[model samples]
Target: MIYIFLAVAFSVAVSVLLKVARSRGIDIVQAVATNYVVAALLAVLLLGATPEAAIEAKATWTPLVLLGVLLPAIFLVLARSVRSVGIVRTDVAQRLSLFVSLFAAFAFLGDTLTQAKALGIALALAAVLCVLWRPERGATERGGWAAPLAVLAGFGAIDICFKLVAQAGAPFASALLASFLIAMVLCWIAVLVRAATRAAPVTARSLGFGVLLGAANFANILFYVRGHQALPNSPALVFASMNVGVVVVGTLVGAFGFKERLAPVNWLGIALAIGAIGVMASS
Candidate 1:
């Protein structure tokens, strides 16, 4: 559908933007936090001045807020991971999201688990490691190995949150609000942690970057939330595939666009990523 393609395109653009913004000396975490703020404002606007719709959407708020809390911490880290590790492996970590989400769905939402999903998870984990692994002698050895792992854990939790929030059926915008508020809280906590540790004092640059990042990040998620309505399919497939698309795009970006080269062993991770997507699609 046109909406699906639009969703994919918007998402890709966001991914590319993250990569591009880093070169501008943007603080990835701050930028992401800003994006959430921008997105939250939009969500509030969409929720409208009336109280009725907002009240009815309380169910949606809970999950969205919970997601909001988790995402900033996870995605803020992801922004760093992407910069340190490159988009390819970052995307691979995202693919593993499906496996975590699948379990959450089965356990909490009572969704049926097929053998196809299990196989997909196994392949996805392999794919993630493959993408994250760099074979070079020195610097390449540590090229975001830990970052990808952290992203893997964060994004897995994110997948389930997305599913739960999707089911909430609030104005979608309400859910976005919850997400933003939570993310804001978590991000600020990080800032506090940095400050307490006597890291650099809050600079205008960090604040500005956080604001910009939040605005764009808000746009990024708003698109995802609106995508379900725009695309008529179940959000599950759409979300999963959107993640897969990110990997493909990130890999290409790293390899060709950014000139972030990888060894043959690492390329296998990309291949496995492709395979994992196939399994997800089929499942």
Candidate 2:
């Protein structure tokens, strides 16, 4: 439970850091690229992850590459989402993304769709729409849904790719390290391209923020893994607690700490999102 609490805290902290990055003049691209560097190093030092397993003939490069691409790309989308829609909605959308992978499981991975899972998926869909709704149409609301929706889809695809990698017999750490390295390279490429085009300048501030982001990001993964280890017989509890905790905590932070206003429908969406996770976990 403590591990789950830490994981939820770090998860929301990532969004908070991203939320504050732009106002601080942080170069998000450079920070994101640097984040992979830090994550890859931590993977090796803390997790003892090595590339040996990733190079095996049976290891699938397709999903690994997809993860590499999606991780950083979605990260950028996530930042944009936090900037546009605020953390409450963005976090709910992200947590609800399990439905995408859930549907994929039923359609492609041969997982049975139980009644509980079906109801959870339905609730998740309704939650997404509610969370994405903007009661007041204005300049700020225009195109706001795009980033959160992308966050939802992008994370769902990333989860599917992770499943594929696991199915290929690649150990979690090795797959994570490999994907981090690839994502690092891709992000650096984008950073360099932007620098060359004068779209954004790489700065020490951005690099510093990247280090913080990476630490939080890796901590989230580490604690979640530890939570599962700590409760080996209660994975569903850890899963549900982690997801529901993030939504609840993020909402509090966004609403009180940041004073972000939310409509009643948005609150309903948050409740539905929690309910969906609970239902799925029970199933």
Candidate 3:
């Protein structure tokens, strides 16, 4: 439970840091790129991840490459979502991405489609609509829906890629490290391109924030993994607690800490998201 709490805190802290980064005019791309540097180091030092495992004969390169591509891309989208839609919607959208993976499980992964899972998917779809709702000339910035919706889909795809990597027999930590290293390379490419084009200059400040973001991001994964290891028999419990905890904590931080406003429908969406997770977990 303490691990779950820490996981939730670090998860929300990532969004908070993104929000602050935007406010402080930090180069998000550079910061995110540098984030993978710290994350990869932690994976090696703490998780004992090694690249050799990822390069073994049984491992597949396709999913690893896809994960590498999607990780930084989705991270950028997540930053945009947080900047435009605020933490509340972005976090809910991210958690609800399980629906995408759930669909894939039923359609492609040969998982049985149970009634509870079906109901959970329905609830999640409803939650997406409700959470993304913005009244005409509302408080939310214009085009706010785009980034969060992208977030929902992007994360869903990343989840599928991770599943593919697992099915390929690549150890989790190794796959993670490989993906981070790839993402770091790709991110730096983007940063250099932007700098060359005079779009954004790389700065020490962004790198510093990147280190913090990476620490929080890595801490989130570390604690969540520890929580699962701590309660190996209760995977559903850990999954439910982690998802529901992020949604609840993110909402509080967005509403009070950041003063992000939400309509009643958005509140309904949050409830529905939690209910959906509970249903899926119970199923």
- How many clashes does each candidate structure show, in the order listed? 11, 0, 0
lDDT (0-100) at residue 244 of candidate 3? 100
State the local distance difference test value for candidate 3: 0.92
| Model 2 misplacement above 4 A | 138-142
lDDT per residue as tens, model 2, 63-171: 8888989999988999999988899989998999989999999999999989998999999999988878888864247576789999999999999998998898888
Give the per-residue lDDT of model 1 (tens digit) for 15-94. Answer: 56666665876656656656666666766685442323433665655656667677777766676777787766676776
**Cα deviation of 75, candidate 1, in Å:** 2.7
> Ten consecutive residues with minimal summed lDDT in candidate 3?
135-144
Q: How much lDDT does each candidate structure score? A: 0.66, 0.92, 0.92
Sorted on TM-score, best first, the list reads 2, 3, 1
Off by over 4 Å in 3: 57-59, 136-142
Pick out the ten consecutive residues of candidate 1 with the lowest summed lDDT.
46-55
Model 1: lDDT of residue 70: 75
lDDT of 3 by residue, 1-283 (tens): 9999999999999999988887797888999999999999999999999977785734458888888899988878888999888999999999999999999999999999999999999999999988888765453555877899899999999889888888878888988999899999999999999989999988999999999999999999999999999999999999999999999999999999999999999999999999999999999
TM-scores for all predictions:
0.77, 0.96, 0.96
Model 3 TM-score relative to the real fold: 0.96
Clashes of 2: 0
lDDT of 2: 0.92
RMSD from true fold, candidate 1:
4.1
